[model samples]
Structures are given as structure tokens and as C-alpha cells.
Target: MILSVQNYGQNKSIAKDKIKVLENTAQESIFVHYNSSLFMVGEYMYYKIYCLNSETNKLSHISKIAYLELVDKEGERVFKQKIRLDNGFGQGDFFLPVDTRSGNYKLVAYTKWMSNWGQEIFFSDDVIILNPYSNNQRDFLESEVSKEDLQSKSDLRPSNSALSELNKSPLQLFISKKNYGKRDEVIMEFEGINSKKIPDGEYSISVRKYSPVFPNQKKTTVDHLESKEISPPTFDNNITLPELRGELVTGRVVAKSTDIPLENLKIAFSVPGEDYQLKIARTDVLGQFHANITKPYRSEEILIQLIDDNVDGLTIELDDFASPFNSDKVKFESFRLNPEMNDLILKRSIQNQIENAYFKVKPDTITSNVNELNFYGTKGITYLLDDYTRFPTIKETVLEILDNVWLTENKNDKYVFNLRTLNGEFNNSEFTSLLIVDGLFVKDQDYFINNFSSNSIEQINIVKEYYRMGSQIFDGIIDIKTFDQNYAALASKNDMTALKLNRQTEIKNYFRQSYGNESSKDLERIPDLRQQLLWLPNFEIDDTQRITFFTSDLKGDFEISIEGFTHTGKPVSILDTITVE
Candidate 1:
């Protein structure tokens, strides 16, 4: 029996002879909560991710990892990081470089499983980063007339009364003081209507300079000023939906001559540049298959080769899918900087320079030796290379100085090295012996033996018995310690991949200044240029959850916005503004 599944909203039919697969497959989505949409250079962008099953609106456990990419305006990846998700939740931070240009960037997030649907399902948001010291300047002022004529128009200055009117909101928000000085403490409180206790929900508060539009400003011209309020997720009145996933690649295989469906055919997905391990997928009864790549491809195209033995007259059809999420639908209120805000920006910029300088002088120390204290609870035979005389080559030292090691010339005139037990029993097993240099895996022996010098060796460790690491079982282990941690660089020249075994994310403590109990003399010595005065990612609103944070050395109106979802998936948003003079 022939079964044809019609493509949704398309004239073509897919999986002509296979069962309906689309209806049986589940849909997944990604939701990310970022600390702020706008950032300054030299600052860290922190975010929390939540992966959910769209149909059930519950957290998904299918994907254990998520790929986060920061892309520039020209579609170039600024940075990419793989985040390990736990129970559908993950958190990560990206540090913005000081040399980054002042422009709009994007934060894209998706999981490997989500890629099967298509890139249209990936979650993406626009992020604006400003670098005051950047040579490339983005004009904030727009006009058809000359700069002098534009400045001459008196209506350019927004009235101070309008600024006060925009500060009001329906959500009950309270401040400890109406005005604050530079580096002063700002306390805030939030409650439901009629002073009732606020319900449990997720929230994000953003404080930024308020930008006001002048009367002379044209509506058609795009303003460079950032939005003061945080961008909240779109909801259907109260129901919150799941986030979109990443790009998806889908295709079908059919017999070229008879145009018949080719079922159970294995296809390989790989990039041609490097020998990346091929990802394999099998066609279903209808000759349809799909694969999800968590991140966008660095190259414009990818190669898909059939793995079947007989491929004389077989054809593959690729499809271009549309993105499911529309960024334009998410709206945010526009804000223009007034005189007071402009003054605050100038002072904050100066303080930022001081902080950056301080960090440079006292940089964070990162430890290079990850396995210093832990050595798999086993200490094998150790040979200190420094104690013995240096040999002309590593092969000579291995053959002469080392015991239970064999070096023999192969038929190709190349040398083959093997490790044996003290009893002269050759350590022969199904899997090759594990070779490591400076805690990095050594995949190729020629790359290690030829490039690595005997003089640069620090020590050698050998394990004669079989070793087991997770699912990998090695016949034995040969650990080579280097004098310096530069073995990876030297080995990379021989067309080999040398990767750091440690995958732990480095912990960074952000610099925070305190003046509450400090002496007056100490206050004068410190410069405060903190644009983001307070950032609390996981804030709970229990009885003891009193929000208190000190303001930075700037004078202007600081906005407080709280956004999150309730236990029942109801979206909530609260806004309030406080002035600091």
C-alpha cells in the first residue's frame, strides 16, 4: 500500500510510501531569561535557559545540552559555548570584549533535538551592546538637514513634565527615596493590588537611562537610543508559550530510476573541511530522514552522502523550512535620553574605565593543571625525565632508558611503539592503548613522536594493566608530562587535534564596591562607574525577601521592571521608576 504525506502549506508530497511521521513526533521549544537586553563593553551577559515540550507545556528531558551563539550584525559568530542542561534548566554567562563595536547583536539558543524541526524553531533575541571608547560611532541623532540646523530646532528637547508622566504604572511599586545621590542605596518593594502579597513568579528587573524623544525628532527615522523597559514574552492574554528551537535539516531518499522510496537507507552528515565525526541517520519506511544541528553551520553548505553500498541511481531531495518564530511580533517601548540621563551616562562611562583598569592590574588567576590533586586514584610507573641525561631523540630514550616498552620498524619504514608488562607480555587488546600528553588525548603517534622533543619532556607514566574511563576501555595508558604547558601548541602543527580534557566553566567573581561602613578617606580613593548597579538573577519574593541594592555614582531616573511567569503559566509584568539626583 502506498501512503503519501502532504507537506503542510506546500504543494509537494513527502514520504510517499512511508507512515505519517509528523503527527507522531513531539515538538520542543526553548525559553531564555537574560539579565538585560542592553549591555556595555567589558560587562558579562548572564542568562538562564529553560527547555520545554510545546504540546504539554512542561520541561523537556530529551536534550541534555544547549548551544548558545552570539552573532554580529553581519551574521558572523562572535562567540559560541555549549551549555550542559540539568533537568531542562541551564545557566551561562558571556563576557563582552572591550573592543566590541556599538551595534545590534543576537543571542541564539537551541538544543540538538530541536534542530530536527528546523532553524525557524530556534530562540533568538536582539541584544544591543554599547562601547563608548569604540572608534566606530553610531549616530544617535538623525535628520535631513545639517547638524547645525538640527541643533537649532528648539523642539528637540523633550519637556521634563513628560518624563514624570511616563513614570507611572498599574503595578504597585514603591521606592525608599524619591531622589538619590551617586553611590547611594536604593531599596524597592513590590506588592499585589490593595497591598496583598505578590504571587510566586519569575521576574527580571532592568535599570537603564531613560531616553526621551524631542518634538523635532522625526518618527520615520530609526533612533539609536535603547529601550528603557525590559522586553517581555508575548502571551495570549495570560497563557505563556514555549520558546523556539534551532535550525533543522530534513530530506528524503528515493530510487533514481524507478522513483521508488528507499527505506532503511543510512545517510551520513559531515562537513568537508575537517574530518568531523560523521552523524548517521536511517531512512524510515517512507524514505524520509532528518537531523538537528544545535548551532548554525560555520560554512554556507554541508555535505550529505549516502552510506548504502549500492548507490548507482539514488537521488536525495533537500527542503528549506521557514522559521516558526517572528521577532518583529515582540514589541518594546522606545526611550530617549534627556539631559539628566545624558549627564549620568558621562559619569558612568568614567567609572567603568576605572573598574576596567583595576581588573587589568589584578587579573583573575586561572589554574592550568586541572588534575593536580586527582589522578584517577591510581599512580602508575613514573619516570622523571630531568633526573636522566637527555637523548638525541624520543625513540632512543624509549628504547634504551624505558623498560617494558618495544620500538620496532614497520614494513613502511616507519616506527611502531608498544608497551609491555614487566614479564615481557605484550599488552595486546581490542582497543588501542590510550596515549596522553599534558592531560590531552594523543590520537596520532607520528604527531606526538616527531614534534615532541626528548629535552622538553618532564616525566613519563605507564599503566600496564587495562584502564577503564566511562565507556572507553584502553589496553594500557602512556602518560607523557611536558616541562611546560605548551605541548598542545607544538603538536597542533602536525595536523592533529589537541583539545583540553577539562570542560569545566571558569568561575569569575565580578567586582563590587561597598561604601556603607567605609571611612570617608577610603571613599575618595575609589572611582565608581557601574552602569548596572544591581543584578540578582534568582530573586525570590518570600516574607524575608526584601530587595535592597545601592545605586552607582550617577544621577538620573533608574527604571525597575519585573517580568516572569506564574505557576499556572500566566505572564506578569510590573514597572516603576525612581529618580537619583
Candidate 2:
């Protein structure tokens, strides 16, 4: 009996150790409030993502980027976006293609650092999208049958009248009318308790179709909320915003004989076949090291080696920390359109097709900002390729047609282009010239010389003086322009590292129209096929706020749902329905 008591105490001690391990590790959670649950083809699905620390339920400062994906039933990713998070908040939009199949889709969100755990912890939600142009009669029939079954089951369930009488939330929702007509204006009012005590609450108001098949699915939403509630507080209280560290690979090192953490261990990452610049990092106090590689390597595998000269009894453990969001608790709702709504959808689909065709033919009318060009304040010597029509090879074209440049061979039997100074001396000690083709870096000199043809070269610009940009310094720069924008396509066939240039996220302005005090004739002339009547992503409830939006030409029941978090981190959802005849 004494031995049994001792074993019980030992088991308790082991359990406590396991709990401590979990407490030390940092975890992240993501929450998103999308405009609507249902969408039509050619429409945009707008959403705002909120990333929080799992332990404190506050905005996470550990991850600066969030990934959003739209996956189909067959586990295929239809669309993906890498959103930049500022203070753990990001907003983006996904355009539903017209050819998309009608079915239940998933919207998943997560961060790169959060991937260290399993993907099951990622936030996921269901979105029902319908393509009126898709001619899948079998799918439509199945969807209709499912909707009928759900409506029947819902009718059999007991009424909420008794439950409503027992408890009431502090929030109240009101609408000007219970019914509306197509292109009619809808006014809404929301009231709550004292604003001072509650603090102004932020909310997302969306008007989507009401369907029993999609009835209040509680899997991802509830699990994400519950996990935040249960996560223990972190040991550290200092909140620091995460920096944009590129392609982080983190791991720990320890001594094999003594089982002691090895601090300041040097780790190096290099490409096996290519002459890539080695990336090095050092282990911290906890024997943990994170390597941030700024460029992308084309090799399939990278060799990671311990740079320490004396590696007698050291052991290294390397693993990937990519965890994706899970949708285990996600459920789909079915929506069936009435005859009137179906007719309107058909008309809208045709209208969208016509608009798309028109834009394709007159694309020049849609201009982009010229200030977004990357080549600014750059003045270099330019040589037109057309001036060298008789050259047989690119090397011949460069040497015969261009001046102050010559070719030299290295010890590895590889040809290297050397940039000559005005004094006719080779400027090639430790400094290397920068080679760029169509705004992309050319890492392999041999690949560039052999692949680029003389005819394909449109122009070449040379900057002989030392050029400095950010942390990089080049002895000189050689910029090659191709006749066609096919530099990436040509470079893809080689083993050179091609780094993608970062571009600003395109800002999209949603289409909005109003017909205030206009005649019916004027309204009929314009195409009124908007599936989303009103989308208010940022809604505050400090005082009574009135929202006004005119409905489209679609006649159906539009459900208004307000979902948000209170100042105290409590989740709230309010629902109401309006009919437009």
C-alpha cells in the first residue's frame, strides 16, 4: 500500500510536468467575420480577420502574416491569399468565379508561426456559394432535397418561445419593416445597455439567405472560442509586435552526452548543387535557433549543417512548424432559391458575362498607377537589341555591340561576365555585379548566358558605378529587358534562384449605387443584380445607429446577422429576417 501511494504521487508529478511544457509554448488563434455566409458567382466575399494570443485572448503580436484559403469538398484549394497583418488585424476579399460549382465551401485562416502546432487548431468556417451559370442539374436536385429535409426537421423541433421568456440578452435589434420590395431601402436600429459600462461594441452586419440546412453551425466558431477560454495565461506578459521575418526555420540543439542545451551553436543552410550564398543563424539561450532566408531557392532540397568545427557529442533536432487550420466541426447549410429569385439570378449572370466581355476588348481604359513602377531614379547606359541585328549569339551581341564589358572564365569552367571601368581595368576583386532580367534576379550566370537569345533581348542597361540599395551593395548593375515579358518562364527551366518581388496589395472599391427619389424607368435601365444588398463590415453600437441600404432586384428573404465580440471578449450573435417581394 505504501508503494502504491508513492506511484500515485509520481504520476501526479509527471502530469504537472506535462502541463508546464504546454504553458511555456506560445500558441495563436484566428477569428474572422465575413460579410455573408451565402454568395453568388462573380460577387466578392469580404472578411476581416482578428488574430489573438490563445493564452491572453488579446491581439497576437507573434505573427505578422495570415493565410486565407477557400477549399472545396474534394479537398482542393480553389483560392488562396497571403494577407499582411497589422497588429493582428487584416482585411481581404475573395472574388467567387462565375464557373465555380455550386456546393459547400470552407474559409480557413491561420498564421505561419501557428503552423508549429497541428493544422487542427486553425480557424475554419463554412461558406455556401452558388453558381447560377453552372449546369449541374444533379447537384441542384440533391441540394433541393437536402433543403427540404432540413426544413421538415426544423418544423418538427419545439418553438423557442419558452426559452426566450426565461432569458434575454442585453442587446436588442429592430427593423423599420418586416417586409420590403426589390430596390427598396431598409433601415435598421440597434440598442444596447449603457455604453460606458459595456464600452462600444464592434460588430459585422451581413444580409444573407436564411436556410435550415446551414442552421447555426457551431463547430469551428464554438471550438475556437472555447479554446481561447481554456488556454492558460502565458508566463511572459510583455507584448511585442512580431517583425516580418522571411521564411523562418526554427529548431533547438542539445548535447547528447549531458542532455544540456547548447547555446550559441552556429547553423548553416545551403543549396547542394547550386552556388547559393549560405544563410547562418545562432542558437539562443534556450538552444533554439530561427533562420530567416530572404530569397527563394529553386532546389528541391536544402542541406542544413552544423557550422561548429567541433561537433563531438552534439545532436540536432530539426522539424517543420507549419500547422494548418482544421474544419472537423464544420457543417454546411443548404439554400434553395424560389422561382422569382432564380429568374433574377439568370439575368444577373448574363449581365456579368456581357460586362466581362466588354472589359476584355477595352482593357486599355482600365489604367494602373504609373507611380507603382519599380524603376525610379535609375539612370543607366542603355543598348537596344535591334541595333545588333547581325550578331550570332548573345555573348557576341554583348561584346561586339556593347562597350566596357567582356567575358572571363572561372576555375569551375563557368563563364563569368566582367564589368570594366572607364580606365579599361577589370573591376572584379571581391565585389560582384548585379544581373537582373525583367526585374528578377539572375543567380546563375551560366544559365543566363546560354538561355537568352540575341533576338529575344529587347534592351540592356548598364550601371558602371557602384550601386547601393538597402543592405545590398553591387559593384555595377546589368539590367536586361526581353521583347516579351517571358523572363520568368525562361528562368523556370533552369536551376537558378528566382526571388519574387513584393507588390502592394491591390485596393478594391466595391460597387455602390443609389436610386434615391428616382423614377422606376430610370431604375429599370440600370443593371440591378447585386446579390449582396448591404455589407457593413465595421458596425459600432455605442448609441442607436441607423443603417440605410437599398435592396437589389432579387426577391427573397434576406437574413441580417450581427456577429461580434464584446469589450470583455464575450461572443454575441443576433439574427433577424426581412422579406423582399
Candidate 3:
């Protein structure tokens, strides 16, 4: 929220107003609760993000998008994704790829609004990865160890978390039993020590087998609450606005000839696909324009163009979404692989391979109920092409099958589509009808009329009433749907500038296994080598709630962790252990 002002006289007043606005804005912080700090090559790393108001420590409603990234020891991004936040909560997961080498890594999470403070206030955690298949184990091995010493020397031991003298969390975990057989159902309950301090909040539950190889101390909700009380660093005159609406797409418009910024220009942008969106933005005093995409679009690229009749040889340049912050400042701790852990590593590797081999039988499903709505509301007259006789050309099909719609030339001698009133009145309005093809804006009506075949079109929609978007109004709308849905091929590359956009990450429904079912009986022969019994990345905790999940075939001690912030912004961290015989 800091802005550097170069000209003290011209922009002096504007700078003061901007600084006043930022000073009133509250800062934000993030907390990420992850399943485990240690992982094998084939395991999935699940996490949940909680955005908080730095002052109140409650869920912040300022930002709608958050980013999560996994960085290596050298600070290069290994994986990054855009998460669509819903009321300050989001969840995602990543599977460890086989090609990833064994090393110590870090997971960082932050919202673009949090960037105003700096990367130091961002949420970060250490992660240790073990890869037995790759030869990149040099970092985890002794430099002078001999070949014989690497096989059976018993010096290597797993790292353990040091016991702390801090006060325990008020939240306690209640389980029905301490031990159970494989595939047995276990129910865990949550309750607070005092009735007034009941644990009620949005929490994440993870039941993972304790990693005995390279386990690192996992930070809890309380730890984050204590460490995240930092304030915004002193501003050196750099400012970034918060994305209050949605994903913010920003750029600058400049004159093509002199490379000078052009101010007060209007730009029309469109994201083309089934869920395409159209938006309008205007350049400010700095020649920069900001547009917020309110919803998720299917297109990987966007089209932007000047809305004016004469663009005056102006061009647009989009800013990259990559963060400018340098992540190379992070330091990693050393974790050496000892020969004593070789037997345990081999067993886990074999189990992972077996579980992957039968993965096709039990695959995760994508929970997609994306409510697709027409960019324009649902009040247009639709036509089904198959209901009538087949026509060869678009002009003939529209003339014969359509009603109250026709193509005519405008004052500029350009062909444009016009819609008449349903009462058969010839509309002589000043505004032209908006033409669209497969969710893409079509400017040149002549080109589409002559080149597009009726055989390629599936349906046509006509709206006789005037339509408005932003400050622009159209007399009517002519929306056409093509069979192939390939709007990119029809888009006029001459008038539009194509730029890549970083869209929100897709949501998925994690696979869950249950016993005593018909499908479970059929897969009884397949080995159940799952180490992590259950993972709920977004679990809502009530006053006294019960959770039920069946244990896996893997027999060992599993850690149950519930970490999050309560409705009143109080930190709740509870831990317990269960043994599966």
C-alpha cells in the first residue's frame, strides 16, 4: 500500500490522497495448516489457507484470491497455483512427482493484498522430502561415508520435535478407543476444557502416519497466532491495491509511435470460452488500467482492444502475474540420511508403488458444480437449428429461420445485425446490435456473414431489448453458438491483443475409502497400503462434533491433528495419537 511519487509538485496532492486511503486500510496475514511436514515421493500434500485481519485476527473479507507456492532450497518455484478464496478460507493439495529429488523445501502462502506488507509477513513452513528412487540423495548423505557404511551403519536416526514448556491448548481430542484393527471405524470427538471456551471454528483435520525418517516440527494454529502479530513494514513509497472484487488484471496503454503512455483511453477486454466474460476498463492519469475478473473463466488467454473508433495507434501492455519478490533469502536446515533408516524407507517406497499400481481402480473425482450462467441474463429468444431444414449459408438460415432480425449496412457502409421490436416495428436506433459467436465478440459483421457456414452453427439467440454492460449500451444482441465452439479461429487478430491470464485453480473431490460396501468387497484382493488414513483439508468444528473414518490396512501409530482459528479469532490446536493393530 505504498506509492513512490517522483514529481513532488504535479502529483503531490494525488500522493497525499493515496497515502491517506492506504493508512485507513487494514493489513492482512495468512496461516496454512498442512497434513504433514515430511513426505515421500508418492504422497499427497494437503493444506488449508486461513486469511486473517492483522489487527482483529479474524477472517479478513478484503481479498478474494490467494496464492500457494512450493519453493526449493535455492528459492525457485517448484509449483504455484491461484486459489479462489471464499470468505477467507481455501484448500488445495499437491502430489509429489517421482522426478522430484530428495531435499528440504518450503511451502509459502499469501494473498496479493498481503504483498503490500512484504514477503516476510507471509506464511511459510519447512518440508522434508525423501526420494529413494532418485540419485539426488547427496544432500541427505555423509560426504565421507564409505559404500559399506551406507548399507548397515546404525548411526542414522530420525529427527524428533523437542518438547516445549508452553501452555497447552484448551481444545482436547476425545476418541472412543486407543487401538483398533485394520479397516475398523473410529470416531473422534472435540470438546473444550471450559464450557465458555468451546471450540467452534473452521479447522483442518489430518490423520497421517508419523514419519520416522525425516520428521520436522509441525507448527500449529497457536504458533501462527503468536508469530503473526507483526505490523506493516515502514513504507518507502511503494503501493499495491487490494483485490477486493476478484482476480485483478492490470496493464498500461501507450502510444505505439513514441512509446509514451496514453491517458483517458477506454479498453474492452474479453475472456473467450463457454464461460467467457466481457469487461471495460479506463486508463488513469498514469496510463494504467485495472480490471477485476469476478468469476472463473475457461480461457487461458484473453483479448483486449481499444473501444474507440480510431485507436490513434495506441497499444496495450499487460503486467505479468508473477510475484516480484525474491524468495532466495530462505535458509534450509540440513537433514542427512542414515543407514539405520534404509529398511523403513524401502518399505514405504514399496507400499507407495503398490498403492499407485491400483490407483486406476480408485481415482479421485473433480467436484465441479460451477454454476454456468449466460453473460447476459436469461431473457433472450433461442432457436434450435435442427428443428428446421438445413441451410448452406448463415445469411439464408437467419433470413428463413429467425424472426425480427436482419443484417443491414450502417452509416459507415459496414454490415451490422439489427433486431426489430417483437410487434414488427423497424428499429432505427442509433446504437448497433452486439454480435457474438461462441462467447466471443464479433466486430466485423461482414466477415462473419460471408465466411461462417450455417452447418457449423448449432443455435442462435436474439434479444430485441436494449442491453447494457458497464457504460456501453447496445440496441440488441445476436448470440450464435457453433458446433465446434472454436472462437479463437474466428477472432480477428488484427484488432485484439492476446495475453495470457492466470486463472483460479480447479477444485477436486478427494477419494475416500470405506469398508463393508459392495465395491469394497470386489477390491478386497488389492493391497491397501495407504499410510495416511484420512485428510480433511476443510473441516468445520462445532461445539461438540463427532467425525467417523475407517482406518487403512497399514498398522502403526497415526497422529490426529485439528488446527485452525475459532469464530472469535482464538487459536485452537489439538493433537492425539491412535494405534492400528
lDDT of 1 by residue, 419-458 (tens): 7865678766555566666655554565567656788888
For residues 357-389, could you state the per-residue lDDT of candidate 2 as single tens digits?
533322222123234222324657889877666
Angstrom error at residue 581, model 2: 4.2
Clashes of 3: 5
The Cα error of candidate 3 at residue 452, in Å, is 1.6
lDDT of 3 by residue, 268-377 (tens): 77787776777878887776777888887668877777766666666566666566346687676455676667888998899999998988887887666577768777
**Which candidate leads in TM-score?**
3
The order of the candidates by TM-score, greatest first, is 3, 2, 1
| Candidate 2 C-alpha RMSD relative to the actual structure | 11.4
lDDT of each: 0.53, 0.58, 0.75
Q: Estimate each model's TM-score.
A: 0.56, 0.57, 0.88
On a 0 to 1 TM-score scale, where does candidate 2 land against the true structure? Answer: 0.57
lDDT of 3 at 533: 77
lDDT, residue 407, candidate 2: 72
Task: State the number of backbone clashes in model 2.
Answer: 7
Ordered from best to worst lDDT, the candidate numbers read: 3, 2, 1
TM value for model 1: 0.56
